[model samples]
Target: MDSISSRIEKVNPSLTLAVTNQAKAMAARGEEVYGLAGGEPELDTPDHIKAAAIVALQEGRTKYTASGGIPELREGLAAKLAADNDLEYEPKQICVTAGAKMACFNAILAVVEEGDEVIIPSPYWVSYPEMVRLAGGTPVIVDTLESDGWKMTPEQFEAAMTPATKMVILNSPSNPTGAVYSEEELRAIGEVALYEDIVILSDEIYEKLVYGETKHVSIASLSQELYDLTITVNGFSKAYSMTGWRLGYTAAPPAIAEAIIKIQSHSVSNATTFAQFGGVAALEGDQTFITDMREEYDGRRQFMLARLQAIHNVRVVEPKGAFYFFVRTGDIGLKSQNLCDKLLSRYKVAAIPGVAFGYDDGIRLSYCTTLDILNEGLTRFEQFCREH
Candidate 1:
């Protein structure tokens, strides 16, 4: 066989998906498994959103859309940004893509190049560094501490910058860690990016999943200069439980948006046609589903937090947003992967290793499943810790 491209070789398969699939396969074999590795909600897509897609399909709305997306969806997204996120964007400055993952990749490929550097914090979403590598850019990972709530500070951002630094990726309500940046923290970090003229790829896909007094803020909304340098990516997968719909969009400055559109034109062409209609319904229809989902997740988050805190060898920070607990398992004297491997094989509980998120001594346990499952999984997890 011919050699694969070197660029492709540098990327790793998503570990979160790997763990989820393995757990699913085990369940399919009729083995009992408690799954806590997936990042998606267990809820079904709302009826209104599904009905809109069905109507579109019946009307033969399967034709290809403009590479940027259908006009109505983009307009709806612009309005969504203005109303929900406090960021102003025109429809012309938006590009819809297959998923939020694609939106992030497209934005990275549009601006990143060989020898350029992109800053990512530790315990980030696993794909961020890999995407940068695929774009031929170097990923400079800065490690954030548990003491600071696992958040990157403005000083840390400034210290990580260099002449080759081209961009910084921020995921508020971050994956793995579930750390939500406050408005003040975002303004301080935005100032650093503004002064350095570095582009910010702000992934707010979990924008609606925050709990308690926690709030999601778009760095782009902090100021016009920050807005001009930001590519704000969001989608319906998490908020509306439309993961299978494969719809996401980016709101960027005109030049960056044009670049992303050109990239989409040559690549996926556009997001699925009928799916865009579902996206429009997701934006314009009743929003009560989001609030209900958030409340349910908040309950689960509390349940898991209290349970994990009671375990002897485990340490966890209370996640203010998102449905995950990035627990410290290093105290048990095992690397994350080995611990996770044993947990899945012996305890029949699946969880993602923290090494995948750039932290080797921890593991990410998601609360997206039911309380019964979480109770069983954590019970087994506690037994495993005690034995170790």
Candidate 2:
């Protein structure tokens, strides 16, 4: 009898994790490796948030409250949506999940059906397409251009739609590219969605990591039509340095939110109880820590950009937000995977290939690590470019 499910037969391992793990293995063997593949903040979780979690643990808030989340966290998330994003979602319209990734997955699974088409822009986070596949949906990959700063134009989005189209994924301060979409651009895309009557999944997990003059806009906030059709996903991982806490939330229409909760209850139940308390604290507590982290990240982004710009033929679009630089590698006569492999094995620097993110001719390097590691990795990157 055949054993394994075909559900996962074609799924690829996470390229970012694969590269990071290989670098770790090499380092374990005493190789001097600079791992720049993963997008995790180097900062520790803020002490105040940790104290909130500790207080929760001490009070024995260890059991599951609701599949959506504890009422306090949900209320905090609701207030956050209203205050920060200018989108009003009642507590009932929100569902907390293990992480923003899981929230995204839940949204996809809740709405997408077999043979339904999900329009994913090129250079997307690797998980978007995979999550669509897991939901038995067809991923309609639309290519965005470097000349356009890697954003999907309204025309491109409209061109990709069909009667079968169910949803589209948009990430601002996009992973791997750090391309922050302007409000004008998002409104244009939202207009397309409103005209086509397609659902939009707006992933704004990196909403707070933007650089100078780059504002993060929630498409749902632009109009009620977009809000009705949008499911906004966010988490504490990027902004709060709480990646290990596995706390995230989705704000959708009431029906969609309930559907997500139904699916979540049957599967993962709720996010960790104490972690949800921390999430509440993250939202309701003092936010000065976020400004500090953003400032530090801006500094690193500037350093990384300058260094990469110095490398000949390695053109990079200035990333306005997030912590990644997608360096165009077409000038080097090698496929992205091959280029990445060579960089890791020969130079001991780990970066993810752009092919993993549905783009070729580039590779994504994360600047979320320390300045010393970034300097070392970039130095190796320049040497490798010169040799090639």
Candidate 3:
């Protein structure tokens, strides 16, 4: 056999995706799998957004757009950013990409060179370390304590920074744990960024999915310097139920925006042109659809957190925002992957292991499924805990 590319060979596959495939294969065999492996919203995209896409296609908006994005999208997105996040950005400063994932990739690719370091908090998103490795940068993981709601502190932020540290990734209403940083917490981190001249890659993809009285705060909104150093990455996937549309954008500094556009042109060129039109409507049209979905998800988030608490050994912190319950199942004493495997093969419930998120001892339960399915799955989970 021929040798593979060294860069590809050096990186591990996405751990979340591995569990997703395992669940999918099980479902293919006619298993009644109540899967919660993927973080995607299960709700359908609202009809209004789809209607806009159809209208765009009919208007011959199917052709290639400017490499960054169409002017209309950039304008709409610029307005959405200012109105929603309280940060002002011009159309040229915004670059619409394939998804938040790709936008982050482009940002990292643009800024980091070989031997650069990216600081990520532990129980971090599985993609962070892998992406850094693929970009020829090292990921320095800072462990946030469970007592602190799995959030990094300002001291830790300062300690993690070195001359080689080029970027720091922040995920609010975070994945895996669903923890949200308070405004104060963000300001503290922002201060560190101000001191170090380090870049902040704020992944606010789950921004709008926050629950209860909590709200999403863009670090850029905290101060002017934060606004300059921060690259606000977001998309319609979770909020607008537009995961299938593959639309996301980055609100970055002018220089970074130009670099990202260069990378975009050489790779994806432009995201689906029709989807960009849908995005314009998503930003401009009835936001009530997003609000309604958040309400439904909030109910499920509360319900799922309560149910998990009932299991004797599992300790779960109620997520402030986002629809995930990352549980600390101390009594089972099994690796999260092994437990996830057992839970799926026996109970037909597919929760992902926390090892993927750098928490080897826990498991992540995505509560994005129907409430009835969640109840049924929780029952099976309780029974599993009892037996094991």
Candidate 4:
């Protein structure tokens, strides 16, 4: 007997994890694999943040606190939002979860339901459509153009809306493409969502990783109307290099925040107790770690962009933020999966296929690793491109 629920059956396992795990297994067996498929920063979490968690543990703060989050962390997040993103969210309007991923899932479960249509731009983070499907919502994928820097225009969002449309998932400094939407672009999209009464899920996990002159703008901060319509999700995984800590939060309007807290109470109970203290330190402690990480990622981004452009038959837009580069490999004449397979199996380099991100003509290469690994990976990748 097959007894899996329909929602579970509809979900696809994360292709990013599949590739990264395969690469890890091969490396464990002494294989030389240049792994570029990961999403987390290679940098270490700051000593201060870790010390805070250790202090919490010493003080026996491991007991479960509020279902949404501890009061201290929630208050810290409120202050951070107001000072950094210019979004004024009270502590009660926040729901901290295991990760930004869970925060997104909880928001979807709270607001989306059967027959609801969620407009998600293509080349999205792989989990968006899956989460919508799990929530019994129809995911309307709007294929975005590379010429538009893989961002969905307001016109496209308007064209995709229906009476059944309930939400739109917007990722700035997107995971696969690293497309950071401008304030004007965000305002235009927010206007459409406001007019249509569609909810907005703004994923800003990569907010602190932006580079060059590209500024990260929170759509929810554009206006009070957008703020009311948006649920903002962020976490410590990227910026703080705290992926294993499992701490993230959602800031939403009162009703939605209450709903998210209710769902979380019945599910995960809350983010880990001591870890939330680390989250407090992350918000309030010295922020120089972020600046240092951003500078290093920028240097790597420039180097990778130059090397990729020099390679034959490969095209990549310089990513404005985030560490991944979505590279067009259609000129190589094989689809993304087959191309990535050959790279991993033969060339000893692992990269995620673009098919995972809803774009099959390309692949995603993460530049968060060391320059030596990147140099070797690009060398092998360039060879594969030449031979293919």
Predictions in order: lDDT: 0.93, 0.93, 0.89, 0.94
> Distance (Å) between predicted and true CA of 84, model 1?
0.8
1-388 in candidate 1: lDDT tens per residue?
A: 8589989888999888898899999999999999989789999999999999999999999999999999999999988899899988889899999999999999999999999999999999999999999999999999999998999999999999999999999998899899999999999999899887999999999999998888889999888899899999998899999998889889999999999999999999999999999999999899999999999999999999998998988899999887899999989999998989999999999999999999999999999998899989989998898899
Supply candidate 4's per-residue lDDT for 17.
91
Q: Report the C-alpha lDDT of model 4 over 1-388, residue by residue, as the tens digit.
A: 8888978999999999999999999999999999888799988899999999999999999898999999999999999999889999989999999999999999999999899999999999999999999999999999999899999999999999999999999999898999999999998899899998899999999999999889999999988889899999999999999999999999999999999999999999999999999999998899999999999999999999999999879898889999999999999999999999999999999999999999999999999999999999999999999998
Q: Give the TM-scores of the predictions, in the order they appear.
A: 0.99, 0.98, 0.97, 0.99
Could you give candidate 2's per-residue lDDT for residues 1-388 as a string of tens digits? Answer: 8797687885777987888788889989998899788788989999989999999999999998799999999998999998899999999899999999999999999999999999999999999999998899999999999999999999999999999999999999899899999999999999999997899999999999999988999999999889999999999999999999999999999899999999999998999999999999899888999999999989999999999999996889999999999999999988899999999988889999999999889999999998999999999999999998
Once model 1 is optimally superposed onto the true structure by TM-score, how far is the C-alpha of residue 57 displaced, in angstroms? 0.5
Q: Each candidate: how many clashes?
A: 0, 0, 0, 0
User: Candidate 4 regions off by >4 Å?
Assistant: none
Best by lDDT: 4
Q: TM-score for candidate 1, please give it.
A: 0.99
Candidate 2 local Cα displacement, residue 31, angstroms:
2.1
Q: Per-residue lDDT tens digits of candidate 3, residues 1-388?
A: 7589777877888878888898889889888888766688888888899999999999998988988898999999898888888989999999999988998898889888899999999888888888898899999999888899999999999998999999999999798889999999999999998898889999999998887788899998888878889898998898898888888999898998899899999999999999999998888888898888888888888888788878888888888988888888767889998999899999998888888898888999888888888889889988989898
Worst 10 residues of 2 by lDDT: 4-13
